[model samples]
Target: MTKKKQNIIFLLVVLLFTVVLIFIPTGFENPSLHKNTERVKAVITAVNNSDLQNHGIVTTGTQNLKINILAGMHKGDTISATNVLMGQKRIDKIFAIGDKVLAIVKTDNQKILTARAEDYYRISIEWILLAVFALFLIGFAGITGFKALLSFIFTALTLWKILLPLILKGFSPIVSAFAIIVLCTTVIIILINGFSKKGLVALVGSISGVGITCCLALLFAHFFRIPGTVQDFSETLLYVGYTHLDLPSIFIACIFIAAAGAVMDVAMDISAAQNEIIDHNPSITTKALIRSGFNVAYPVIGTMTTTLLFAYSGSFMFVFMVFMAKGTPLNIIVNTNYVAAEILRTLVGSFGLVLVAPITAIVGGFIYVRNY
Candidate 1:
């Protein structure tokens, strides 16, 4: 077969494999009953933000609602459920006082109450915004932007639909995370560069970098004496009967998953730069191509180091400030799980960042340049 046809076949296989992975059963022990209890259509009565007496960011917002219990045993009961907004920092507005919404209802001992936030669809605005941005990107960058958007969607879907489900199903979180890293890297690289030698080189480099990142996260997470419970929402899952879950391994998995995108970005950048050097100077020796990789990797390394640092630091700035205000010692503060996790994340990812240069340089130089 011709090179073009071979590339096409390779992409089809990868796409097919990704699709299959979505249907793979995750063996989660606890299965929730597939049931919707009751429907409560409630209109928000008033919306106001009030300050909590002793809390920093906590606010007391009340949702006064007129509820029509439309389904289940509570059918025809026109009751009012008042929801108090605790200081939980959710992505949505957590029910404004006057925002009309629906609720899931459950009854016990003749008391009918709201069960869940069935009407959390208020955050559809974020989805709408993302859709508009995707369209704008497609319009501006044309085909390249469209491929980028697809890569973006695949990244999000694989994390949510594949990885999360597998983890909840009691699958080995490390293995699942590794599989996701490979799948995401392959999808994104091939999508961006097509199925050429450049894409292959990028795929190898990214995989190697992710391997290094995983090893570092495992070693350091163990060394630092941090527990898996450091990860947010872990305890909550345990309370909900997912206590059999292996959380430390999952925590380790999260480290690389978070770093995978940045590592892939670095690997592709260096590999592409080396490829350009070879194309421009076809006679350029492998040594020169390797040097070109170094040239590209250095700036990328510096920028990415800060990129990871700031990305992590921004989220924890408030916690840092709280510690500082309380006169907590730097050593103790740094040793806290919250602070230590960021340190591990930044350092392990940086190690991968450091290692990608040589991997991409050597791989791109030898593979694309026809050196044995």
Candidate 2:
């Protein structure tokens, strides 16, 4: 088949998969839970904070709001809504008059009963931010940026539509995650690099590195005695009746899944570099090509080695701050599951990054240089 024909077919398959995912039912969101509630956009006309009380920096109690509905069946209706505070600043919101809010209006037979100021109506701003990002990407990188956006959407849909659903359906989290990674890795590399040696080498090397990371995570997690409950909200899943889940396995899956992107990046870098070298100098021996690939990889691996640490540490910075504020001992902190889990994530992810470089280089030497 022609290369152009292959690209057309690949895009069509991706589009079909995306459409299917959009309409796929995971059986979890059976809207009966919120059948009587309708989300509406509204402006807070007035806020009565008389019932609210201050306890330290956190506020607890409720603010009664008079909201003028701007959309939905309740349009033009003025209703009273409650914004409750639970003394947790992180999850709490304080709204002033004239602020736009998302109002959850409860109704039976189209008659309004109660309303809640659920949160700010920030969806508009979120869409605007996304539009800005899309514009910048396409404007700068043109066709390649557009392809990257499609891959980004595909990855997100696969995680939400396929990966999480399978895990929730009692499938093994480790297997479910790996399958999604492979699916994502294949489509993304192929879509960007097309049906060629570059894509093939990158895909193979990326998966290999991810596999190594998964093994290390599971093996070290056992030695580290990570109960998996250490992951944020993992225990909450058990409380909410997903007792069938193996949290430790899911935690292990998360380590490699997080690392897979970095692995793919390194692999693609080496593969693309080797392919360019071989194209420029066809007589370049596989050994010389391998040396050149390694030279290209060394600088990338240096920067990438600390990339996971920065990303993982940023997510848990507040937790680290809390520990510091409490003056926790370094020995105790290191032994704690929180720090241990972060250690596992950083090290395993970095290991995958390091492994992918040489794997891609060695694989690329034979595949691209020798046309194997």
Candidate 3:
């Protein structure tokens, strides 16, 4: 079959898969009581905050708001809303008159009992931002950018629809994650480089890196004695009747999944470099092509290894600051479970990046130079 027809078929399959995922139930819908709670777009018509005073501080406090619902069953209805302030800056919001917001109206037997301000209605703005991003991506990279966007959407759906559901349904997290990573790597490489020698080299190298990372993560996580409870919400999952869930294995799986992107990147770099070399010098031997791949990967490996360090450390900057402020000892800070987890994640992921480069180089050598 022609390559053009193959590309068209691949895109159609991806689109169909995306549509199927869209309809797949996540089993996290609201209960029957919440069924009467309608999220509606509302405009604040009035705000009365005269009775809001907390210890002589005029901070965020309760405000009675008159809201006009613009959508849902109670369209064109003006209802009273209570904006409760919890004194937490992140969750609290003070609404001004004429401000548009999302208000949750609770009803019993068709009678509105309470209306609460949930959040600002920002979906339009969010879509505008997304549109700008898509426009810029397509404008810059053209068809490649379009393919990348499709891959991005596909990866997101696969994780949310397939991987998460499987894990929640009691599947082995490590195996599930590995399978998803392999699927993502294959689809993404093919989407970008087509189903050719470059894609094959990249897929093999990426899977190899993921395998090595997974094994190393499992081995080191066991020896480090860091309980899976170190992960946020892991203990909560057990407490909430999911006692059979293997958190450690899930944590190990997360390590490779986190590194998969960088590993795939390194593999693609080596593969693309080898392809370029082969195209330029058709007579290049396997040994010379391998050397060329290695040359291209050297600088990339250095920066990509540090890339994992920066990415992992960025999330823990606040923790690091807290430790420093408390004057914690180096050994204590390093041995802390949270700190140890971050260390393991960065190091093991960097190891994957380091391994994928040479692995890809070797694979690319065999694929690209074999023909010559």
Give all candidate RMSDs, comma-separated. Answer: 4.6, 1.3, 2.5
- Clash count, predicted structure 2: 0
**Per-residue lDDT over 1-372 for candidate 3, one digit per residue giving the tens place of the 0 to 100 score:** 988788778877876887788898887554885787888899999999885766543355688999999998899999999988877766778889989999999998878999998888998789899898888988999998988888888899899988987887799999999999999888888888777888899999999999999999998998887777888889898887889888888888899999999999999888988988889899999999999989999999989999999998898899999999999999999999889999999999999999999999988888877654
Candidate 1 Cα outliers beyond 4 Å, as residue runs = 1-63, 67-79, 85-97, 100-102, 105-121
lDDT of 1 by residue, 26-94 (tens): 445233442434554555444333432325775555555555554456666666665556656663345
TM-score, cand. 2: 0.97
All candidates in order of lDDT, best leading: 2, 3, 1
How far off is residue 38 in model 1, in Å? 5.7
Q: List TM-scores for all candidates, in order.
A: 0.81, 0.97, 0.91
The digit string of per-residue lDDT tens for model 2 on 256-319 reads 9999998999999899988988888999888998899999999999999999999999899998
Q: Report the number of the highest-lDDT candidate.
A: 2
Candidate 2: give the clashing pairs.
Answer: none
Q: What is the lDDT for 10 in model 3?
A: 87
Whose lDDT is higher: candidate 1's or candidate 3's? Answer: 3
lDDT of 1 at 81: 60
